[model samples]
Target: MWAARLAAPCLLLAAATAPLDARAAEESEAQPPAAEAPAWSGSLAAYLNLPRGNEAYVTGIAIANRGALHLEARSNYEGMDAYSFFVGYNLGVGEAVRLDFTPILGFVTGSTHSVVGGFEATLTGRYADAYIEFEYVPDAQPSGYAYAWSELAFRPVDWFRIGLAAQRTRVHDNGRNLQRGVFAQVKGKHVSGAVYWFNPASHEQVTVISVAISF
Candidate 1:
C-alpha cells in the first residue's frame, strides 16, 4: 500500500508535463529560416607600373560582388589608354583546401577593342595560396592572343607573404613575352601593398607596386 501511494504522484507528474513537452516541440518546428548574407561588397586595387627606360603608368582594377555575382573593371590594363570590364559568377568549394573559381566574359575598349573570355581561380590553404587567371581575346587583331597571370605564394607570418609571380602580357610592347619574378606583400586588416619585380636580371626589367583596399 505504501509503494503504490508513492508511485501514484510520479505517474501524475509525468502525465501533467507530457502536454508541455509536446507544445515545445511544435513551437520549435515552426521557427523561421536563417538570415541572408550582406547585399554588396567590393574591393579596389591600383597598381603603379614602372619599367626600366620606359614611361610609368597607373592601372586600377575594381571588383564588386553581390552574392554569387561578380563584376570587374580594369583601367589601363591591357595596354596604355586601354580599358576592360567583366561580368562573371563566383563558385567555391571545400575548406581545408578551398578553391574559388570564376569564369568571366567581358569587352575591351579604348586602346584595344575586343571580346574577352576567361577564368580566374585561387586555391588556399593554411600556409600556402595560388592564384591564376587566363583570358583570351578572340576579337583582337592579328589572329588574337591569350593572356595569363599566376602567383604561387607562401605565408611566413600572419600579415606577410612571399611569392613567385609570372605573367604573359602585352601591356607593353617591349618584347618581354613571359616575365617571371618574385613578389612580397604586407596585408593589414582592410588594405594591402605588394611589390613585384619581373625579370630582375634583364635590361627591360619591370617593377609593379600595388595597393588594394577592401570594404
Candidate 2:
C-alpha cells in the first residue's frame, strides 16, 4: 500500500509533462524539409583563401581529390580571432552517382563562446562543355545559416573559366535572404588570379581578388 501511494504522484507528474513534450514534437515535425543538393561533374581541386580579418590576416588551404574515395579538411578564422576545423568525405564518385558527408568542430577566443557544427552537400552533372552543381548548406549556424547555393561553370578556353552562383541564407528562424555572385578565373602556366563580387547580409556590395601560383 505504501509503495503504491508513492508511485501515484510520480505518475501524475509524468502525465502532466507528456503534453508539453508532444507539442514540441509536433512543432518540429511541421518545419519544412531539407533542400535538395545541386548537381556537377567530378574533379579534383585545391583552394586557398586569404582572409584580411580575424587573425589580422589568415590563410585557409583546402585540398579535394577524387578517386574511388575522397577526403577533405579545412580551417578558417571567424569574425575577430576564432578558428574552426571542418572535415568531410565524398563517396560514389567512381560509380554513376556521388554522396558526401561533412562534420565540423569549432573553437572561439572568449570563454562565453560555444562550439558548433555545420555541413553542406552537392550533386553535379555534365552537359556538353558546361558543368552544373546544386548545393545545400545543412546548417550554417554560428557561420550563419546560408541554406543553399547553386553554381554553373563553363570553360570556354582551356585555362579560362567563368562561374555564376546564387545563394540563400537564413538569418533567423523566420527570416532569410538571397545573394548572387559572379566569378572569373584565369590560369597561366605558373600564375593565376580570380575576381569575385557579391552582396552581403547588410545589403552592401563586396569584392574579392586572389592571386596564386601553381606548383
Residue 84 alpha-carbon offset, candidate 1, angstroms: 0.9
- Where is model 2 poorest over a 10-residue stretch in terms of lDDT? 49-58
Worst 10-residue lDDT window for candidate 1 reads 137-146
lDDT of each: 0.91, 0.46
lDDT per residue for candidate 2 within 79-164, as digits (tens), equals 22333333344443323334444433333333114444444444433321222322233233344332344555676776876887
Q: Give the best candidate by TM-score.
A: 1
Highest-lDDT candidate: 1
Tens-digit lDDT string for candidate 1 (1-215) = 99999999999999999999999999988987788885888899999988888899998999999888999998886778889999999999999999999999999999789989999999999999999988898766666888888999999787999989998888756788788999999999999999999999988899999999998
Off by over 4 Å in 1: 1-29
**TM-score of predicted model 1?**
0.85
Q: Cα-based RMSD of the predictions, in order? A: 5.4, 20.6
